[model samples]
Target: MKNFSTKALALVLWSVIFSFGGCAVMDKNIPGWSQYRNPDKVNELQLASSSIGEGNPVLLIHGFGASSYSWRHIIAPLAQKYRVITIDLKGFGESPKPRDDLYSVYEQARLVRNFILENDLQNVHIIGHSYGGGVALVTSVYLAASHPNLQNSLVLMDSIAYPQDLPDFVEVLATPGLGPLIIYAIPNTIQVKSLLKKVYFNDALIPQSAIDHYAGNLDKPNAKYATLTTARQMLPTDLQQFSNNYASLTIPTLIIWSKDDEIVPLEIGERLHADLPNSKMVVLNDVGHAIQEEQPSLLLPYLQQFLDAGTHRTAPNSK
Candidate 1:
């Protein structure tokens, strides 16, 4: 009788684990999860995206754990003169959360390439921030090798291109066993506030609505799995390997960094500028990693200057 009871208890525990895990794995198929789906791979995941205006195309890619919403301040302003495209990379925002995808920089670059090809964009300019910046660099290299004329200009904002120490929380979250459990248990409000404090130079400038928006995404189904998977694949080694390709980038490149950025640091920006033969660096004062959100006004002039220069150079020569 004792042995039978023990076996029954074991069976019950196994059932609970399988039930929760199965729900997370199957969350991709449920309706009302995402409005945008990739037509090429109906079964696989697709990025949630929005494009506006017309002219030269500009693709905006956000940082790790962030979404297209990160570009909210700049998107519309830029769209007035250019076709601005913003996407929530897979597993970040409203995009599909597939359990099987690797969610690495290389994979994200592939997704960006596919998005450009599917949209039939030519000579698309790319603007990426932090993790997105790393993806932009990889994507630029891939395009230079695969489709030489597909890319125009490249802009990296406080991007993570060189090797550096990962944050303590990120290191902890990347651990094999503890990572999953901690991600699953992290409360939405607390997590949002903590991350904002670390990323923003002035935490007081972070609005409550912004906090709610970020926190709400974290509360989505299977968000924990997506977060953990992304964290696991975000190693500096993956980015550093592409550093050698910077010298080969002939397109007009812009490297923007906040002087006080604690995340990626200003030295990384200097290194990136040094490596890129045709690149220029601009350092903003009194801002942290979240430059777009914290100091959009300061960033606008540099973007305009770069885009205008590209436009002038690419303009048709009068007969």
Candidate 2:
């Protein structure tokens, strides 16, 4: 009986150790446990999440060919203040690449709207980079007309909205019967290497691990078609100006641009600031378009400062 009792105590001790030392044990299998584990499993529409603190909310929308995973380094840190929601946009990253016939900018806006509705958030602030910025702009217009009560502030980070000539690579990709076929022929490795060169001002700054993750999904089954279609749909439009439909949005808008941005260029970001009545611009020097990724430390704090300022109070119909 004494031996049995002793063994029982030992068993309980081991159990306690297992519970308390979970991190140590899990550390051994961290890679398997990581969100990146099931790369084979479609990370579609996944929300890479962390607490947005106690306030309205802030949603971070990633750029083209990137996922919410791009914001992984940011999720926890930003959660310290406002609730941060970063989602893999439709047809990019892990989101479902449904047929273009079905998905439009309107539908993309709906994806955002649904996320907002499902979460039951109000007075939301959306920050978008690259194409995602355009989506946010379009979303602002839609919400102003349809769901004005759910006011949202726009933060455009080098978004492409106006009818600027498409980037040369995109232009080639858009050429009839030539782009898709050509893209299909190039091996993903070569394609990825080329894309990295074009997108980054300092290609050496982008890690191969990041490239692997992006390339892994970017060339997935339906992504190219969907991307082409979305681009084509918005090529000739005053999408940013559609917000003018709402008398005066009066929502505080912040547009940040990288003076050195090679991708979208500074002109578009500046133009967005010019068109939006209640908007301001911040141009960072020596930093290319993808400021969030290129210089997160310098970029994020500035954004946080914007959020914390009195600017958030600029509601159109204020109490």
Candidate 3:
């Protein structure tokens, strides 16, 4: 019995050691992880973005934990007709992740507003996916209230506008102490691949290159912490409140959702459509949450039609 007890204790010690030590190993092996662990020199970080093509500006905002590269498949195609601007939100992609910053949707919306104003963009059309959709919605509402003439239209793809059950991984990251441990321990490759599987309808559709790209971003300093912070700040009340005045969004809106999306689900899309009086919802079959990457070909026509419709701005009912 004494021997057995000693062995058990030894095993427990090893387990605890590995739990913490694994993150250290990951930090070394994963490219970019070491560099991102340190705080950036600049206090106020500028969002990393690229503008391509010419015509009416269309800004593409990626979802949670995603960078502007998420729109790689569609940017060139859309740029053929309209100026396509893709941005990495402050905490994701190439954007600087400032420590202790609030990664809330409202904060993100403010950044979007700044981007538009600074660029002197007019009649801008916004397209966002997942969390990006939430940011886009908030941005639209703010524009409507402050500068109605500047806002033209919106496209929400599997957006997170309404309160819903958090995904298991997100729930884990949002937890207090355990969240940090998990975030630190998991390697970027493993985390990115696992998430890609969940976001893609067909596992086979996820390319290794895409996984590598996403993992590279995950390795950046403060990336994991930023993700955890964002998750914690994503309170349902906050999201719902931001979307409260969505009914007053009179701008032409298009909501595209994957019929079988396991992430945001179709119900959320339906709710967004119902809330926006002038919005139309298009359900894509056999696709998942990352519709922009997975099914861009199918999405192009709907986007073209919306953009061609031009500004159909009407005054929304007073809230």
Candidate 4:
């Protein structure tokens, strides 16, 4: 038995995993797809993705508790000038949510890295927000060391890169037993609206459709398991050690932060700017953690300028 308010709050606030568990089927047409095909593993899901436009490829990774739909406002504009790709990370949106414990930043990064390689995308740029920023950071590190020529630059928005205290809601939902119970017991439209309100600086700006879309996904089977598991692994043990790689990521990078971000403080963004040798930091006012959703129009110009400048930069270590 769970308290109604507690359950609703936990389910709504904590939304957002990792693991290369196993692939169910391998597409013959996709080279190297056979390698991930395994019947024993449960969560190595093929991501649900969409792409539009042409020219340089840009991948957008959404944050915790969000799906590709978060990019709804800006994808079209970006696609007009450059190829833009958006994905529902495993267990979020339309992607499969297995009753397994494979959700982590590392696992998500692996899937993202695989997506880049399988598609044979050249000089790709990744834009990640919040948790997705953590995933983008890991992915960039992996590519810089392994496939240096494939990835060109990185754009992180209020990302979780360094170790910090988990948000209060995240802590509540990450608690074993209680977390899963709350997620399944009281997920509904109201809870979804409550959650979005916290992310957006302007709650009135959130529309009815956004609530319906997110709430609908929470109602799906096994969605509880995925979100709970992801909360558990939100902060990996090797975070400090892993984050040390930030200094070596010399590829052009952009760090975007909201001055009013309540979820992740602006200080973290300043810290990230100090660490990344080849990075620029931009702070947007009157927005919360959900920069993309709140005012993407403010974000587009920086994105275009950064991408244009980075388009021809030699890949990391190309020299």
Going through the candidates in the order shown, the clash numbers are 0, 6, 2, 7
Q: Ten residues in a row with the worst lDDT in model 1?
A: 25-34
Give one digit per residue, the lDDT tens place, for model 4 in 153-196: 89999999887877655665676555555556655676677667
Task: Give the range of the ten consecutive residues with the poorest summed lDDT in model 3.
Answer: 24-33
**Highest TM-score: which candidate?**
4
Model 1 residue pairs with clashes:
none
lDDT of 1: 0.76
Q: Give the per-residue Cα lDDT of candidate 2 at 64.
A: 67
What tens-digit string does per-residue lDDT give for candidate 2 at 1-319? Answer: 9967765654454334324422110011112112211123222364334344566688888876677876776667777877787787777776777774433444566567667766777888888888787777766765665677675577888887665655555554555554555456555555565666666667778777877887687568898876665544544243334534433556778888878776787887766666666777888886666777766887887778777773345643321
Off by over 4 Å in 1: 1-44, 236-238, 312-319
Q: What is the TM-score of each candidate against the true structure?
A: 0.83, 0.76, 0.84, 0.85
Error of 2 at 201 (Å): 1.9
Q: What's model 1's lDDT at 210?
A: 81
- Model 4: CA > 4 A from native: 1-43, 314-319
* Candidate with best lDDT: 4
Per-residue lDDT of candidate 1, residues 111-183 (tens digit) = 8877887787887899999989988987787777777788889999999787676654465566666566555
What TM-score would you give candidate 4 relative to the actual structure?
A: 0.85
Q: Rank the candidates by lDDT, best first.
A: 4, 3, 1, 2
Model 2, C-alpha of 180: deviation from truth (Å):
1.3
lDDT value for candidate 4? 0.79
